[model samples]
Target: MSSKLNIFEFSNPSIRTLHISWVAFFITFLVWFSHAPMLAFIKEAFDLSSQQIKALLILNVALTIPSRIVVGMLVDRFGPRIVFSALLFTGSFLCWGFAFATSYEMLALFRFLCGFVGAGFVIGIRLVGEWFPAKQVGVAEGIYGGWGNFGSAAGAMTLPTLALLFGGDDGWRYAIALTGAIAFVFSFIFYINARNTPKGSTYFKPKRSGGLEVTSKGDLYFYLAMNIPMYIALAVLAWKLSPENLGLLSELATNTLYVVLLVLFVFQTSQIWKVNKEHLQKGVAEIEKYKFKQVAILNWSYFVTFGSELAVVSMLPLFFMDTFELSAVTAGLLASGFAFMNLVARPSGGWLSDNLGRKKTLSVLIAGLSVGYLVLSQIDGLWFIPLAVVATMCCSFFVQAGEGAVFAMVPLVKRRMTGQVAGMAGAYGNVGGVTFLTVLSFVDASTFFMVIAGCAALCFILVQFLDEPSGQMAEVMADGSVELIDVA
Candidate 1:
């Protein structure tokens, strides 16, 4: 630790890293989410069908599931500096391609690849963990995740105005391209300025690159079981695009995707074995290990928290317009409240986690989330607008706060594989979104919300199994000495 350090001091080395890391994360999010506010412009310009628009939304998140896992391995191996820079630069190119896309298919392809950039969130998880001490890591990570997440809201607020400033049907293209350009330039800037760790601190790597390393045979089984939802989500997306469903893809193409998914699953399963073979054959010393169950619990917790957030955000505008018979602009502005909470609620979640215990904080918030959703499900046209707004705000707090609480536990899972852990948990959040949205495709609006409430109830049960992180987790330094990283 540095002699000039005081945890209360905001200018400490750890806080500096938190500031820079979150800014980079914020930029990544702003670019990644730039499409939402401009969707009307895109739909009119491209003359896309409702199904095509849905597919495009799905495409935006399609590759993120596996991309997060791969990026996690790469970050744990090469360090965040190179990985974050490369992801931003490459994603910028994809964004540029999306902006210039002349056909729906081209736009879909580029957008899907752009999802890889979303993995940048996992990179900061590792970076923040490396810088912050255990006791404060909860608040530090909460601030990084909560504040950085505001980028989406920033994009929503600014990108449309920028497009109008250029003043034409093509203005949306230029506005979106501007985000890409910013990301590309910042990629190089971040590469030049950022260091993976403090001058003398060690950067740890995972024991293997292929999958998360587990300490126990039971955890290995649980880890394997937990991966099912991600694949299921992809398969559902494929089905949605298939000829039998939305007809966005021909039967041949849809069948091909199904085959590709199966092959990828087999390959991923093999890699999991490769990473854990030694531990499976002979377990490591108890002192050298951490349970994979913690990651599993977070995976489910995020599925409900972040997952429900994604689902609610996607549907709220439509729900408001349909339910209240409001104008499109009014519905949109009302819906924006769902996201606006990100600014305060997430930081509040972190503050709560800092003052309260992580597991306790999460349990309380998640319980509130379940009940909130249940209340939201009962709303009808008779409800006052102010009351509806209040309902949304209450539910939004638990959703965003639950998100803050989830990441509060991410860095504490495993010192060497923080990226991988965050990646998996984060990916599951998307899986939850897809699953919940798919349910919406069949159900009424109120029913859809009730379904989320049901899912939240299940997640609350899973949260109980998540152990409070304590003691020092062991990692090996480059000098062949053991280092103990505090988790409590």
Candidate 2:
């Protein structure tokens, strides 16, 4: 690692890799969310209810939680270039399938599977981490994440306009299909141009492929424990579509999914044990030992940070329209501001983490987010719209910035497991969405925001326990050599 590779000065190769990686992620997100802005059109086309629409939204993310874990392992083992490109190309096909779906069931199936592409975020994180040194990883990942995340915002801004330009009952379908085609073609370009690392740099491989390697017995148990929540989230989603809730799922189908989920959980736990059994018994060196609990804490933190962001962004427009008695168009534009903060605040969060300490930066951002949400909980039509906008914007900064800070620490946790680590953290974001949205069904919109604030406050306390990355992590190379990657 070299100080000369600070944020301002980096090799063109690193910069180019970052740019390409982020764009790849951006395009994936664009494809992932191309349906969102056109939901009204889809609703009309399908004659859907508000509940079914929400269920469709829920379905969009249902597969993502598990797909992220699978994709993470694939990236860690096979490298990001192949994994990401394959995801985009295959996901593009799914997007096209969704566009042509004549039945709601078929559309839901394709949209749910498209969630797999959301794991594109994990691939770019590992790619950017490989290209940049530890000193600059924060900003590089920040830029990668911030700019890449804007794809959803970009979709919100552009897809509707594109649909209008096409001008027909099926215009939304064409607009969405165009995004898929772009993703499909770019997948080939990404595969051809993107390298796992700069020439002459080693692309480090994990010791095992199927599961994460843990250094100690405690970490092994902790890893198993962390996996439980992901399954729980899936179960929650199933329940939401079950007869007891939205009634979109038959009792038999819902129960079958639950049983399958349980079996999958058991299989995953078995793989985890098999991968790390020897290492847990032999014991790793002190320098190589890192707590899996750190990853666990961040998992819960992101469940709130990015999770709330996802859940809130989905419902905010309707929340505004109902509460403020405003037009859908105006409410949607106002809600767009929440996601718009990603372009700047997310990078600012990472920059702050780099200048300050990771824990300190996370604590401050979480606190601000908690307070911001609390203030948001108090909003009413009596308040001025500008004041309301200010409140939302203030909360957006903390929420998106907190996301940047959380990832600031992600790459630092374990180098070999960075993809898996990031993947799980990312899964929790979906988990939070499922969890918070369930709460929203039971409570008022104001209480929903307050619930997230409470969750953030709990995560803030947990942030105090994280050990800042400062020294180095040792990764054993294939040639019986040890490579020291900087974590400071």
Expressed as tens digits, the lDDT of each residue in 1-488 for candidate 1 is 32122435665667677777888888888878888789989999999888888888888888888888888889899999899888888879988998989998898888888888787898988888787776666667777787788888899989999999987889999999998998999899888877888788888887778999887788778888888788889999889888888888999998899899889888988898888888778868777788788898898888999999989999998898999999988988998898888877876776677667889999999999999999999888899988998899899999989988998888888878888999998999989889999999999989999999998898888889889887888887777789887776
All candidates: CA RMSD (Å): 2.1, 1.7
lDDT of each: 0.86, 0.88
Q: Lowest lDDT 10-mer window, candidate 2?
A: 1-10
RMSD value for candidate 2: 1.7
Residue 137 lDDT (model 2) = 79
Q: Compose the digit string of candidate 2's lDDT tens values, residues 386-423.
A: 78988998899999898988888898888888899999
Give the Å shift of residue 31 in candidate 1.
1.6
Clash numbers, per candidate: 0, 0
Of the candidates shown, which would achieve the greatest TM-score relative to the real structure?
2
